[model samples]
Each structure stands twice: as C-alpha cells, then as structure tokens.
Target chain A: MRTLLASLLILIVIPATIALGIVVLDDRNYYFISLLIILYTMIPFAMVFESRKPQARELIIIAVLTAIAVAGRSAFFMLPQFKPVLAIVIIAGVSMGAEAGFLVGAMAGFVSNFFFGQGPWTPWQMFSFGIIGFLAGILFKKGWLKRSKALLCVFGGLSAILIYGGLMNLSSVTLFASTFNKEALLAAYASGIWFDLVHAAATVIFLFLLSRPMLEKLDRIKTKYGLIER
Target chain B: MGRDSFSTYHPAVNFLYFAAVLGFSMFFMHPVLQGIALFSAAVYSVTLSGGKAVKFNVIYMLPALFILAAVNPLFNHAGMTILFYLKNGNPVTLESIVYGIAAAAMLVTVMIWFSCYNKVMTSDKFIHLFGKIVPALSLIFSMVLRFVPRFRHQIQAVSLAQRSIGRDVTQGNVVHRARHGLRILSIMATWAMENAIETADSMKARGYGLPGRTSFAIYRFDRRDRTVLVLMIVLIAIVLAGAGMGENTMRYFPSMRMKEQTLFSGVVYAAYSLLCMLPVIIQLVEELRWKYIVSRT
Candidate 1:
C-alpha cells in the first residue's frame, strides 16, 4: 500500500502539480517551480527510509558509500570529466536496496555541493543522481540488470546520457534563460552534448573497471558485518 | 574576517534573515528593489569575506552578469520596442534587454546572498534546524560530513604509501598510472569499510536508534533574537504586501509596464532594503557601540 501510494505520488500528483504551476504562475517562474518539484520528489524516499528505522551498520554503510563518492572526485582531479561518483552509486544500489541507493546518491550530491559551493542547481543535481541510483536498484532487484561488467557499463552510460545529462541541460534552460523556449532548450542541449558524452564515457569506463572489485568488497563487508540483512 | 555581530545572533535569526532576503530577491524584479538588493548583498558579502568577496564579484559575477544579460535578449525576443534585428532576423526588443538585465541581476543577487549564507549557516546549524524533522537523514548528513574529510585524508595517506612503494598514480605510462590509482582507491575502500564497521559498532553500543535520543546544541534564542526575528517578520510582511499590490514587480512581456510609484511603494522599498541590509546594519551599530565603550574606558 505504501509503495502504491508512493508510486501514485510520483506519477499522478507530480505532473499535475507541474501543470498547475505552469497555468497559474508566470512561465518565467519555471526555476522556482521546478526546484520545488525536485525537492518534493525526495520526500517519499526520506519518509520511507526513516520509517524503516535502519540499523546502525546499515546507516553507517550508506554514509560510508556516500562519503566515498563525494571524496572520490579528488582522485581524478587531473582528469576533468572522469569521476567515480556515479559508479560507486551504482554499486551501492546493486549491493544495498533501492532506498539505500537513493540516500547515498542524494547525500553525495548535497555533500559535494557543500564543498563546491551550493547554488540553484543543487536540488537538480541531487534529483538526477538520486533517480539514477533508484532506477539501478529497482532494475537490479527486478532482475533486468545483472552483476556483469558489460551490462552495468551499458546501464551506466545510458543513465549518464539520458538521465543526468538530460535533466541538467533542462535545468540550465530554466536557470539561465528567462523563458523556456524550444530554441533555447535545444541550444543548451547542443552546447552540453560533448560534456555529457564525456561524462557518459567516464561512467562506462569507471563501471567497467571498478564494478567487480567494489561489489566484491561490499559483499564481503555485508557478509562479515551482517550489514543490512534482509 | 572576524565573526560579525549579526552572525553571533541565534541561528534561527540568521536563517530567517537569509531565507527572507533570498526569496524576496528572487521574486522582485522591480529595478529599484533589485538595485537595493544587489547593492546591499554586495556590501554585506564584501564586509563578510573582505578581499575574497571583492575578487569574486569582480572576476566572476560581473562578467557572468553581462554574459547572461547579453544572451537573454537573443533567446527571448518577446518585448515590443525593436532595438535591432539579429543575424537570425529575430527582432531584438528593448523590453527583453531590460528584462535580461533584471533577471541577471536577480540571479547574481541570490548567489551573493547564498555566499553569505554559507559563511553563516554552518553544517551544525543546518543539522540542528532539521534534526527533529528528519532524524535519520540528518544523522546521515552529519555522518557523511564527518566521513568525507577522514576518507579524503585516508586516500591521501594510501596514495602516499603506494608512492613510497613505487606504485603511485604518477609512476608509469597511462595504463599503469590508471591501474595504480585504482589500486589506491581499492585499498582505501577496503580500509574505509573495515574501519566503518567499528564506528557502527560504537554507535550500536552507545544506544543508537533508541527512543528519546536527544542531540545537544549550543544555540539559545535570547531576547535579542526575539526582537530581531519580530523585526524581520514585520519587514517581510510589508514586502509581501507590496508584492500583493504588484509594486515590487514589473510586467516585461508584450510591452514593459511598471506600476506608478506611490508612497506605499516607497515604504515597501525601504522595508525591503532594511530586510536585506539588516545584518550589515547590525554589524555597523555593534562596532560603533564597542568603540564608544572602549573610548570611555
């Protein structure tokens, strides 16, 4: 019942809210409305995670994963677009459950922004990273995704391109442009396509190389400490 | 820079001030209101961080303002009075150019406000504000913040250790360097996982997740905080009243139309400026009082 309600909130209520906002408010106010929507989407995830009352070990594991992803950017400072954040998030989703995945991704986004400087884009980044992790976990649990390198890499690339790139570009349109015209949006996407491709390639590369060992490490930790036992 | 008097107030006061200012600055596109907000934000920021804020405003924000303003009229071709024709034959409109400047100024103003916010609202204050509401997530936030620096330190140590063993990230060709870097990361991950188990055990032993767990905080909302909070609310209410009267905004679409400036609008602009400049004003008053006492002594 809770899952059904959450799904309903995401599907029916959110779009309705967006449509209402568009009709009622000025189109120039897209930034505020979109930000509120992004924030609203995180509510159910937080509520569910809190309701579960996860164990200390489970919480610690999630915190550890999030911190790793946020701090992992320093490892490749020389390589501009290459980052291990999404790869670690995907591994977290595959190992832990969907809730844990979302927490890790969202927390990483928030915490990293603390270091980089928070702006209007913080919520959008959090939502993008979070939904990707949530999808990875959901797909893996449904058996549509697998533990293999080829499959995880494919998923990672597509997520970076479609979800992260797409949402961030849309946010740029709302952010920089006064009006949300098709020409402005397309131009933003056109300008950002190369950056997105690099990011996608980086994710695929990281997943290909890091997924096996990272998963093994997480599995070992879980079994050894009995973390997040179902 | 030293801790300003305003920041020494209660966190609630500080948070409320920024929230009100940021919300108002984002919504109000009236030229006078924008000018007031932008100037106050710039002054407060420079007062807060000194030279760094000046450098940031000059080097980054100034150029960004111009670029955003220039870019907006190109994309938006909405307003009436045609300034000129672009290469793409879209008529460059005066209204769009003015709207672009307003939008750019608003964005920059909000960003400067956020910069001040970051300096004032530390993570502990944020956790304090939200802890009761979202206990688990707040705990996770605190934990992650604590863990980030530690993990980064550990990664550095691991890399240094690997370097001594001739297997560092800078050791060889591209593939070898990549392999070494990955090896360091893998080692760090193993270390983090192993140590985190102990951290979790300590939390478990300390009665984590128990009912009625209370967190300690240092902030106490005193009488001064109450006064400031009330004043801020009154100012915010006045500003909202102005917004309701459409005195704080101008219609830029179709053709630009600004409401006639009235006495009420003047009062609203004053209230808005006071709301934005509250911290800076407080800081100046406090300094003056301090100097007077010191001189008498």
Candidate 2:
C-alpha cells in the first residue's frame, strides 16, 4: 500500500505540479510552485525508504553505497565524463530495490554538492538523478530494459543523461529567462547536446563494464550476511 | 564551519533565515527588492568570507551572469520597446534586456545565500534536525559527509602504498595504468564494505534505533533562541505577505512594468532587508556588547 502511494505521488502528483508550474506565467508562482514540486518529489521518496522498516544494517549498507557512488567520480579522473556514479546507483537499484536506488542517487547529489557548492541547481540535480535511478529499478524489475546487456546499457546511458540534461536545461530556462521562448530553449538544448552525449556515453561504458560484477557482489553480500530483509 | 555565532542559534532559525533570503530572491522579482537582495547578499558574503567571496563572485558568478544576460537578447525578441535589430532581422527589446539582468541577479543572489548557508548550516545541524525524523537517511547523509574526506585520505594512502610496490597509475602504458587504477578502486571498495560492516557492528552494540532511546543534544532552545525564532517568523511573514499583495512583482512579457513605490511596499522592502541582514545584526550586537563589558576594566 505504501509503495502504491509512492508510485502515485511520483507518477501523478509530480507531473501535475510541473505542468501547473509551467502554465503559470507569474514568476512568483513559478518559483514557489517549483520548490513545492521538489518537496513533493522528495517526501514520497523518503516515505518509500522508511516504509520498508529497514534495519540499521541495511541503512549502513545504503550509506556505504552512497559514499562509494559519490567517491566514484574521482576514481575515473582521467576520463572527462566517464564517472561510475550512475553505474553504482543503477547497481544499487537493481540489487536492493528502487527506493535504495533513489536514496543513493539523491544522496550522492546532495552530499557531493556540499563539496561542489549548493545553489538553485542542487535540487534539480537531485531530482534528475533520483528519477533516473527510479526508472532504472523499474526497468530492471520489469525485465524489458534488462533483456540484453546491450539494451540495458543503451537505456541506462540514454535515459539517465538525456533526462538529466534535458531537465537541467529546462531549469536553466527558468533561471535565466522570465518568459520561455521556443527558439531560446531549442538553442539552449542544442548547445548542451555534446556534454549530454558525453555523459550518456560514459554511463553506457560504466554499465557495460561494471554492472555484472557490482550486481553479483551486492547479491552475494545481501544473502550471505542474512542482513535485514528490507 | 567551526564554532560560529550563527550556529549557536536553534537550527530552526538558521533554516528559516536561509529560506527567507532564498525565497525573497526567487519570488520577489521587483528591481528594488532584487537589487537589495543582491547587494545585501554581496555584503553578507564578503563579511562572512572576505576576499574569498569577492574572488568567487568575480571569477565564477560574474561571468555566468554576463553570459546569461548576453544570451537572452540573442534568442528573445519579445517586447514593445525595441532597442535594436539583429542582423537576422530579430528586434532586441529593452524589456528582455532588463529581464535578463534581473534573472542574472536572482541567480547570483540565490547562489550567494546558499554559500553563506553552507557555512552556517553544518552537517551536524542538518542531521540533528532530520535524524530522528528520518533516522536511516540522515545517518546516510552524515556518513556520506564524514566519508568524503576520510576516503580521500584513504585513497591517497592506498596510492602511496601502491606506488611503493610500483603499481601506480603513472608507472605504465595506458592499459597497465587503467589496471592499476582499477586495482586501487577494488581495494577501496573492499575497505568501504568492511568499514561499514564494522561501524554497523558498533552501532548494534550501542543499541541504536532501539525502543525508548533518548538522544543527548548539545543544542538548548533557550529563551534567547525562542525570541529570535519569533522575530524571524514575524519578519518572514511580513515579507511573504508583502509578496502576496504583489508589492514585489514585476512583469516582462509585452513590456516591463515595475510596481510603483507605495507605503506598504517600502515597509516590505525594509522588512525583507532586515530579514536578510538579521545574522549580521546579531553578530554586530554581540561583539559590541562583549567589548563594552570587557572595556569596563
């Protein structure tokens, strides 16, 4: 029942708020409503995690995974965009469940931003990664995107980066322009296309190389330790 | 991030102050309010971190702001007052230009407020407020913070150990270097897992998350905190009410329309500025009173 409610909140309420925020032209309404939408997105995510009645062991494991995901960026310093953060998030999601994935993704952004600097973009980035992780979990469980290694990589790569890049550009539009113009938005997205492709490519590379080993280790640890079920 | 005067306040107050400044910066789009927000944020940030803030604003924020403003006229051609025409026959409007400046100012003001907040709202305060509410997640939040620096140290230590054995990244061809990096990553992963397991065992021994567990807190919400909390609530309410009444509204669609100054708007402006400057005021008053008490000798 709790999962059902969370799903409704994510699938229904979030999109509704976004549509309302976009339709309203009053800048004040747009600002407050956008923040409210972020809060709405966050509350359900926490609810989903808490509803599992996860024990302290499970919580510690989640924290460890989140830490690894945040630190994973520096491990690939040689590569421009090929960070293992997204792969780690995806692995956690596929192994532990969707809520854990969302937690890792959202918390990775939150914690890293403490070092990288927080701003208006922080919430947007958290939302982007959280949604990406959420989708990855769903896609994995449903076995559609996971039917083949190539398909999983393709979906994970294009889905996370494209959604994140696209949403961030939308936020930039709101941050930089009072009135939305189609031409301006198109140009904005166009300019960001290369970075988006690099991120997508990086996500694909990480998924192809790291997914099996990481998932196997997470699975082994989960069952062998007989940790809390949640 | 060390022991600071603002951190002495109840977490609620710190959270509210940041929220007010951020909200006003984003919601109150009037040029006067926006200007006040930007200027006060600039002053507050400089006072908070001195030359660091100035350097950051110049190197990072100013360029971003310029680029943001400059990019608008290139794509946006909406408004009645056309200032000029582009070679593509698109007319640049005065309204778009002005709106661009306001938006840039808003972005910078919001960012400055967050930087100031980062100093004031340390991770301890963050976890303290939310830990009980979301124990597991806040635990994760604090853990992630504590792990970042320690993990950096661990990575460096691991690198040094690896280099001593001639397995460092700089000691080979591309493939060999990649292998060495992965080796370090694998070691880090093992260490991370083991570290978490050990911490979890200790936490279990301590009976964390147990029933009837009472938390010990250093923060005392005493009389002074209460008074400041009420004051912050009042100021925030006034500013928000003023915004609700459209005192701080501006339009930039067809043409720019800034609300004319009125008595209520002036009061709102004062309240908002005071709200933004409350921390500085508290800092100044405390310093002055302390000096006065000491100089009596």
Candidate 3:
C-alpha cells in the first residue's frame, strides 16, 4: 500500500500538478514544464521503486516493460512505417489489467513528451493513449489476444490511432477556434486525418506482422520466469 | 551531482515560484515587459547555470522562432503600412510584421522563462507538494517521468546489442528497416507486458490505493518560503490587475499604436516580468548562499 501510494504520488499526481502549474503559469510553457517534470522527477522514482522492490519481480518486470513501451512509442518518431506504440500498448493491456494498461499508455505519452517536449496537447495525448490501452485490456479479457481473435487486435490498434489522432485534432481546433473558421477546422481535420490514417495503417501492419511472434515470446518469458498466473 | 542543488527547495516556494512566473508572463505584454522577461531570464540562467545555460536555451529558441513565424502571419493580417505585395496581391503590412515580431518575442521569452523554471523547480518539490492529493496519479506520473530516459537508454542498449550481433537496423533499406523496427517493437511489447504484470503484482502485494494513505514529504515551508509566497501573491495581484485593465493589449489590426506606454503601465509591466523571474532569482540566491556557507565551513 505504501509503495503504491508512493508510486501514485510520483507518477500521476506530480505530473498533473506540473501540468496544472504549466497551465496556470503560461500555456506556452506547458510543454517545457511537463517535459522537465517527467525527466527530473518520474524517471528517478521509477528506478528507485524498482530497486527497492526487487523481490516483487513481477513489478520490476512491469517497470522494465513500461520502459520498453515508452521506448517503442518514442521509436515511432524515428522509424518510418513502424507502429511500436500500438504493439506495446496492446501488450500492456493483455498483461496488466485495464487500469494498468491505461496508466502505461497515458504515461508513455506523457513521459515520451520529455524528448518531444510538452505542450497543451500532452494531456490529450495521455488521455487518448490511455483510452487505447484501456480498451486493449478490456478486449484482451474477452480473449482478443488469441490467434483466432488476432484481427480484432489489428482493428483495435487502428481504432486507437484513429481515435487518438482525431481527438488531438479536435483539441487543436478548440484551442484555435477563435482564429479558425469552419474551413480552417475542416482543413486541420483533413490534414490530421491523413496523418492518422498513416499512423493507423502502420499500426495495423505492424500488429499483423509481429503480434503472433511477440505473443509467443511473451508466453515463453512468462513461463520461464514463472510470471504466468496458472 | 549536487544533492543540495537538486533537492533543496520546499514545495510551497517552488509552487509559488511557478505560479508567479506564469501569472507574470500572462499579465505582461508590452515591449518593456517582454524585454524584462527576456533580460531577467537570461540573467537568471547565467546565475543558476552559468555559461552552460545560454547554449542550452539556444536549442529551445529555434522552435519558438519557427512557431512564431508559422503562426503569427497566418492568423494576423491587420496592418496599415504595406511592406510588399504577394503574387496574390495581399498586402504584407508593417503592423502585422510588428505584431508577428512581438508574438515571436513573447514566445521566445516564455520558452526561456520556462527553461529557467525547469532548472529551478526540481522533482522533489513536485512529489512533496502532490503526494497526498492523488497518490495513484502521482506515482504514475513520477514513474513515467522516471522511466522515460531510462527507457531511452535501454533502447540504445538494445540497438547497440543488435548492431553487435550484425543486425543493425540503421544500415538497412526502407523495407528491411521496417521489418527490423517491427522486430524491435515485438521485443519491446513483450518486455512491457512483463513489466506491467510485475508492477501490478507488486502494487497488489504492497496494498496500493489503500484508504487513508499517508505520504512522507522531504520539503518544508520555511520563513524564506513564506516571504517568497507573500511576494509572489503581491506580484500576481499586480500582474492580474494589469491584464485586467488592458495594459497588455497589443493592437495589430487597422493601425499600430502602443496605446501610449504610461508610467503606471511601465511599472505594472516591470513588476509582472520580475514576478516571472522570481523563482529563478530565489533559487540562484539560495544556491549561492549554500555555496558560500559550504565554502566557509
């Protein structure tokens, strides 16, 4: 309980506080502050928490996995035609319950922004990714990760990208609505749709190519490490 | 790493400092105010980080400039003094250009100030201030922030390992690179899944999200913090008043007039900009004092 509370304080509370701070201080500085908060505070805490609870090998695995999920999402920026984010998010959902998946997805977005920088868009990114991961978890519980149900995973990944990107565009419209007309909104949405389509398509392709092998490997790790609940 | 430098601030002081800088920036919009913000942020950077900070700020400045250039001209088309005509015959007016410059300046100023804010406001302060309010959320935030760079480092390590094994994705063609990237993603996904399970089990075992949880804070509100908070409140009040009174309003459309920079306006603007720099100033002073004391001791 103590550890969980501590993790909560370090992860969600501090970031949100910093986000609020950024908002109250200067909307423009939102990105910088948010990035800083993540870099200076959250990263170190994760290391410490993992080290302290080494006996909880599962939690340590989760921390490392969460780190990989973050790395995968970040890798998306550097690699063309790659959708590491969707793959890792789905993996998080399958392993961790819905809340855990949501947190990982949200944190992945929030923390990755440290490299990309934070902005007014960070929260929306968090929310969008969180929802994606959460839904993945829900679907996983319904046996979505099974080979027979693999197409559903692809659809889920695509839906997540589309929804996240679409919502992000909507938020941009809201922010710039004072200066933007319907034409501007339409243009923004149109441009955004193209990016989202690419993102979604990439996610689907990546999942299709990789999910089976990835799941097999994960099941092996779970078995080898005695991480499987059975 | 200097532990004192990283973990010395009380949460209240840090919070006040953050609020002061943000409130002040929002309130001050005049050239003088902007200048103050720019100059003070520069000085604060120099004091807190010495020469290294200036070089660091340059990287952040590039984006601010790009954003200003891209955004200002697109939205604002109101100006009287026509500089040139586009092929489409739209007049590029002086007023719009000036507004663009001002907007750019504001953006840059905010960026610099934020860089300073980031330097001064440590994670310890944030953890202390928000630990109890929402523990689960805080933990998630801290863990993510904490893990991201580590995650980056791990990715680099994995990439290096792959290169050592003669599977370097960097040297591949587009399609090969895509496949390699997928392989990396698959590995990463497997890792994330395992980590989530571990974290969940640990949290469950540790009784996370228990009712009536208590947090331990390393930061304390001292006299200096209190004084800073009071000053911040005063500065915020002044800045808010200025913003409320339209002293910060810049007219770009129709004609360019600065609304006559009054003495009152100047003072208000100065105060606001100073408020923005307050945290940086406080941190610098504290660091210097600590340094002096340590040297003497």
Q: lDDT tens digits, residues B182-264, model 2?
A: 78867776777777778888988999767898877777788888888898889888887887777877778787777788899
**lDDT, candidate 1, A27-61, per-residue tens:** 57677678778887898898888888878888888
Against the native complex, each candidate's DockQ, computed on alpha carbons, is 0.76, 0.61, 0.18
How well does each candidate superpose onto the true structure, as a TM-score? 0.94, 0.91, 0.66
RMSD (CA, angstroms), candidate 2: 3.0
| Tens-digit lDDT track of model 3 for B1-297 | 233232255766666765566445533446777778777767676666766776766766656665665564454455678877767766777776666666566556555666655665655566667666544445655666666776566656767777776655785798877777666655555555565666667776886655666667666677766776787788778877776666765555578656677887877876776676665565667778887888553
Which regions of candidate 2 are displaced past 4 Å?
A1-32, A75-82, A147-149, A227-230, B1-4, B156-166, B170-172
Alpha-carbon runs more than 4 Å astray in model 1: A1-25, B160-166, B170-177, B295-297
Cα miss at A141, model 1 (Å)? 1.0
Every candidate's lDDT = 0.88, 0.78, 0.61
Q: Model 2, range A151-208, lDDT digits (tens) per residue?
A: 7688777776578788877777666655577886787688777777887888888788
Candidate 3, residue B124: how far the Cα is off, in Å: 4.2
RMSD in angstroms, all models? 2.2, 3.0, 8.4
lDDT score, candidate 1, position B138: 91
